[model samples]
Target: CRIQRGPYRCHEKTAGFNFNYTDDPNYGPFLVSVNGVAGNNTELTFWELLVQTGGNGTIIRPDVGIGCYIPEPNDRIILKFTEFVSGSHSVSGNSSNPGNLTAGNTSRLDSIELVVVNNISNTTNKTYSTDIAFRGVLIGAMRRLQTNSGFNFTYTDDPNYGPFLVSVNGVAGNNTEKTFWELLVQTGGNGTTIRPDVGIGCYIPKQNDRIILNFTKFTTNSASGSCTNPGVLLFLVGLFFCFLI
Candidate 1:
């Protein structure tokens, strides 16, 4: 079922590759010539015929005797064959169109010898093989409803979020803001804030700060439930408190 290893080089004058068929009682030995060959009296099974022709020798069908080496476009190649199976012996097109080599198996020919003329083009550059590596970047954020009725959030400062700058509720803040370094010192609050570690950190909008909710400047954090009705209500209330400043 496989072709023999190595390429079968053939010249234009070379006739079809010859094969011997063995006699079998069940199907009876038959003389079968592929491409254009004179019929002979030989009895052999279909499997045996293929095995003798180096069919199982290689990965490709070596019985075809090398496919026409098409070097260029617009080239003509012909394939013929003869099957000797008593009166029932026959031949048919293997592909879509007859006489068209590019059209796959045409002439209903079981096998054919290949001959390459000057139809295909030659390559000057030597082909080599190599492996390639690829890298990608991804950024993400999460918003969740705090068990205490507030919102909890986390985000990275990676470029995947676009430039390093981040504006929360309209106030500019860097990654250090999430660390709550100043808040911890001033308010004696624990350093429990989820600090932005990648690029810039999150900022809680202060009183008098301008803010927008659209994704353009601020995106809803699903982990913080920022887009939820309760989250939105909290944000609005915080904004109202800011205006009092």
Candidate 2:
């Protein structure tokens, strides 16, 4: 069997493995199974498409599905079996500023850096920066980026979780796809990064902080408490009490 051009074509022509996909009106074909294994939403498991770059041997997830992904000659294709957590909302990070700029001076404004990373896309990360008021929310800087730097993003305000980032730079996370923008930060540009327990509306950024907005899928084990977000917990508790009543 001769390997074909696209990923799905390659699978179709190859004899060793089997594959399956559902045709989506907007997104085209969505791969749901491979090698007799199927993705189960109830079990939170899915097949993640990945590629290893030829020369550098770096692994990356392609943003597009099998139908659209044209593999390079030397690219190593990998289909990974994985699980995901529910709920795309939530932002978290922490960083400090040692610079003298502060709101109290009224003359100097603090600025922080924003880096947009798309793990699923084979494109370069985009970097932008914006000035923030003293202890300003992340959304303000994001808005400034849109205004001055041409960077765009859209978010939904969760009544319980505040601002839930819905989309960034025209790429929106889909519930069926189980992908979202995760917020992370490097403190004082010292290289240490952390995911804050708070969302965008609650987390305050310090001067010179490097905020990383990573667009990626969620893959976590069930024992890790992935559904521990405050909003989800509250909803669960409310449902429990309603059942009791």
- lDDT (C-alpha, whole model) for all candidates: 0.21, 0.56
* Model 2 ranges with Cα > 4 A deviation: 1-108, 221-245
Q: Tens digit of lDDT per residue, candidate 1, span 96-131?
A: 111111122222211111111111123122211111
Cα lDDT of model 2 by residue, 33-109, tens digit: 88888877667566666779887999876544454454666888777776643232111111101111121343345
Most accurate candidate by lDDT: 2
| For every candidate, C-alpha RMSD to the true structure in Å | 32.8, 21.3
Candidates in order, TM-scores: namely 0.13, 0.48
Clashing pairs in 2: 63-120, 92-196, 93-196
User: Alpha-carbon error at 33 in model 2, in Å?
Assistant: 56
Model 1 TM-score on a 0 to 1 scale: 0.13
